[model samples]
Target chain A: MSYKAKFRVWRGEGGEGKLEDFTVEVNEGEVVLDIIHRLQATQAPDLAVRWNCKAGKCGSCSMEINGKPKLGCMTRMSTFSEDETITVTPMRTFPVIKDLVTDVSFNYQKAREIPSFTPPANVQPGEYRMQQIDVERSQEFRKCIECFMCNNVCHVIRDHEENKPEFAGPRFLMRIAELDMHPYDVADRKDAAQEEHGLGYCNITKCCTEVCPEHIKITDNALIPMKERVVDRKYDPLVWLGNKIFKRSSSKS
Target chain B: MTQTTADSPARRQRAQIKERTLRTDQWWRYPLVTFIIFTAFLVYSTWAIFDTSYFASPYIAPYASPCLATSCPEGARLFGLAPFGDWYTLPPGLLILALPAGFRFTCYYYRKAYYRGFWLSPPACAVNEPHGKYTGESRFPLILQNIHRYFFYAAIVIGLILAWDAVLALVEKPVGLGTLILVVNAVFINLYTLSCHSCRHITAGRLNHFSKHPVRYRAWGFVSKLNAKHQQLALISMFTVVGADLYVRLVAKGIVNFPFA
Candidate 1:
């Protein structure tokens, strides 16, 4: 089956843009990315879009569809009514380079801020051994394809640009949580997660978890557990007393 | 992708979009609904606390359980003990309401709900909040949410008391529909309490390795499973408690006659 689909794609450069409407042809089993490609081929020769793998794995085709953060490659034309007008816009959190493509360097900046896995001084790479259960704790987060949709949808930075300097958003915060939960990575991430990465800004709205394409429980399994773990160092009086009485040095210190 | 615009001044700033969000979907509906529900719960709980008619023999209202005052009906008194004597004139619910109330208020899930629903702190994901400044929970007052573990302990004690009340309802002569309701409410209370994020953490959160602590690992797994549904349990338990309290209140007022009462 073939039909014409309406599209309202945002087009602009240098931070100025408007939604430009296009009537594009659609085919059976075609995703939004396909219709977008068709628009580029037939109608608008100068349309700008960033895409790598159309298989929904590259995490390169992320755009807002009908006001929801989604992958253009994953959203099928079948999900929308034939007459419905689909709107494609660049992610609102970052600077726009051109149509349907926003500068995602903010995510890379936050990613760089987090300290990578630091193992014990004695344990070699091959010497590291952990239970399957421990591996599963962080395995859920490994599914993240760097979609950056979580960062885009997170309100801390999405609505407030000033917060960009403080909050790490959900994606990198989950990265810190993953390393913190690792059985062998001994660096103490609890303090740095709050003080440096702005873990405290997350009000646990779970919007990141909602928009996650990988179905990972980012809030439940990673963020909340990390928040509670932070309490062991910062808030728990009993833990403070125990540390004082025993004279045990923290992992990082 | 990184080399597309190097050292461009415009690349340093976010896109100058004028609209709060281009979202065409009804994003406002969620927070508005959440506001209405929380407000209704607050209003009903306020009324439930002040009303003294909270007992109907074998079934004590959850809000007024443990009937600490001497003014309480003899049949409704917990094991016929009045700890406060006649010195305390206020409602018994006033004495203990703070505990469960504190638990819910400090709950991680409820924090999200009320923050979005009531405070309008970026009500939905992309919507702009009216507030100009956002310090979040890092400061005083909101930072007190760290005391959630203490509230979790209090909630466990309250859950135990509610369980005892449910048992009393079961054993004290004929069981009515109120008995079933109270029992279900007690179950829900415990479920919500055990499913707490704090509970999940205390079980095994700080452990460096789960292999060494087999028992804590098992407990952590159970709590983690329950914690996934914490939001649903939070809402269900709230409504069930209200329903249980209202049922007992109506029976105490002689408004509704249950079979075998």
Candidate 2:
């Protein structure tokens, strides 16, 4: 059934803003994004919001609905009662450019810092052989939609802006993990992950896993395994003894 | 309309909105509940450990299981073997508690629990933590969490011992309510132990090609499935272990009696 829904949307630009309340008409089977669109079309044409795909896949319509970081398109309007005043705000981790449109360049910057997949020189294209089981390990991480919800919700950068420089956040760390687990890639990601990419900053709160639109187990499947791998190289005494006795060849020059 | 120039302060940096988080939800409830449960477990476990009355006819307290002390009563001693002999005179709980305790302390799931629940390390998602600095698991004491795999081995041995206790209870006379409790607790403990993240890693981790190792691949597949339910198993097993121990202790004290024992 259609009803009048109350919305308290944050509207501002250049760091100055306030929550503007609007009573808008809503229909059945509509999402929060649909309501925002209605408000923009009817009440506030100047309202600035970032959205690309109305579907959940593109990860463009990410915002905080009632203080939880969620995809605007994925969150159903039916979840909230008609009398409830729904509040919409931008992702807290990144800087805001306008209402609900934050400068997400921090994620882009972190993405650039990670080393892409690198294979051995001798292994030519189309010659790669991998087990389906081995392929499946990294395959779960491949489902990431670059939603940055994981990054935005992660408290390491969400509250601490200073951490933005050192920590790569969950998204790129998962990327590093995916490449490290790749059967073909030979780059030594374990050391780089710990030392450079700030893998140690991640405490595996599983918040990233919680907020993921694709339902990827970011903390469990990717981040935790990578932590354990780093432990093998950096901490394990038995591994240290084995390396000392056998003198294993270093992957990096 | 205010036009923003290139030199504007807002253009230069992030919006200076000052609040811990905009989250209107009851985010504090989770950590608070976690804190209460963990603290209660700690207090209960300490009482159960030091009381030294953890034995009835067919049942033994979980915290005091595999009783290794020379002073352990004949019936409570595991496999009728006193490995420590008279050299160790303390309560059986003191000797046997280390392995399982260490395992849980170093557990990945428990780390998240205590860190958020006790340490308030960003108490909940998107909320500000009280600590000025966060070294995480990068440094000395916290870095020691890497040794969780070692504890996993200890936990396996403990699990086996607990299973043996359950078997002993089963074979003895009529199956009492205590026997059933011990068996269920043992099963839950084994499930929790098997579902460890370290177990998953040891099963499949570091292997570049799973095609070559079919057996390990199958084992990894089983473990990966179990690992998904690790957190739930951790909680259930925690409760079961304590409940099992408490039941046995009550029976020993003659405070509560069940049928068939």
Candidate 3:
């Protein structure tokens, strides 16, 4: 006899939700995503779960499977025991719009707070003279497919719901860090990062680092360094003195 | 054709040979080479730390002293050896090296690649085997190295302090020492940031299996090599900065003589 696996999928829209169970025949080469699609076709034709490309690259099928933020398509059903029942739910960080879809517009808003790049004054269009090494640093940030898995897993907004309004979360901070590290970006956004974006709230527990699908060093490379820069302007005695001296010199001139 | 070969030892031996040959390559394909390079860096750092020192007092060279015309009390105090001078020199120097090393290890790229054993022993083909129950035991200390996030905050704070000290050295007109420390801090920051596992992971042109562009694959191949060995240099550069900082501090504290100072 072939093994059969049971899935408890979240069913309903908006505030209405219930776990509906469906038993499906398990195959050797099947992943969790294939089972979900199979259940949708055979049992629940009206199911409205979101997915794209059916590959890990699309970052669309992000949901909590077995209470963990992961791409449904990438998770293999074989990782579980035959007797175990798999529970799937929408990501908790955002408001659920349907059975397995959540609103992620908050991330887009936070992204806008960061100042866009401004090129240097003496620039000609043909080609900018940048060393290969200089451009190499920010290139890592461009890989983000906006999965928001890092945002979902973040404890600041995930566990403490109050932090949502103030906290910019890990994904956008990575964007800010990416822009800050850009060699061509002349504008300094560190002050805005502190005053407006609430970068200081991130205590560097690195929970976001653990769940990142792209494996971005959110706490280490981006957030921590940006915090350090803010602290320098705010607290460093020498910078304070330099600012004061510069102010006086400029006023006299 | 092979009906009579079922019980033959020669056929069995051939089967065994094929199985053994088919076994996946070891994670560290060139362990000896990696070991030698790491060992050389370790030895050099140890030597650099113990060899340098200077007196606690500060004095300005005649050429570019800021106190020449005005009553630069701040400049005078900095010019002559003081507690701030000692405080300024050693701790920040060691920090310069230690922070970058710590950050690199905890980098995001390293975490993912190391978890899957990608860097040391990437499969010859990009295809993954069918998922099964994960049977491996967790490797603890290596896994726990993700604490680099905490270290990054510490490194950044320390780097800023070191940069301030560099600024002080410049204002006091000690051009040589100022340049040395500044250059050391900059290099440490560069190496630390560059060798970042997270940085490497994100910069991957496109994944080999997913990329549609032919040029992206070639670029990814180049970047992947740098990503593979990034963790090693990340450690080396971090320790190098720390050793350099310690040497400067020992000299500033009068515990050793700075041949350059």
lDDT by residue for model 1 (A1-253), tens: 9999999998877577788899988999999999989989998888999999998888999998887899999999999999999988888888888888888988998999998999999999899988998778898899999989999998888877889999998999999999988888888899999899988888888889989999899998888888887887899998788778989654422
Name the top lDDT candidate: 1
Candidate 3 residues B1-261, lDDT tens each? Answer: 323233343321100111111212242343345455545655755554333332122432111122212222343333342333333443222323455446644564334333333332221111122232221111244424434445555655545544544566555546555346545654555545544443333243212121333455455455456545565656555455555445455555656554445
Q: Which of 1 and 2 is the better model by lDDT? A: 1
Q: How many clashes (backbone N, Cα, C below 3 Å) per candidate?
A: 0, 0, 14
Clashing pairs in 2: none
Best by TM-score: 1
Model 3: residues with Cα > 4 Å off, grouped in runs: A239-253, B1-261
Q: Supply DockQ values for each candidate.
A: 0.58, 0.53, 0.02
- The C-alpha TM-scores of every prediction are 0.96, 0.95, 0.50
Instruction: Give me the iRMSD of candidate 1, please.
Output: 2.3
TM-score of chain A of each: 0.96, 0.96, 0.89
TM-score of chain A of 2: 0.96
Q: Give the lDDT of residue B199 in candidate 3.
A: 37
Q: Tell me how far the alpha carbon of residue A154 in candidate 2 is from the true structure, in angstroms, after superposition.
A: 0.4
Per-candidate Cα lDDT values, in order, are 0.87, 0.85, 0.55
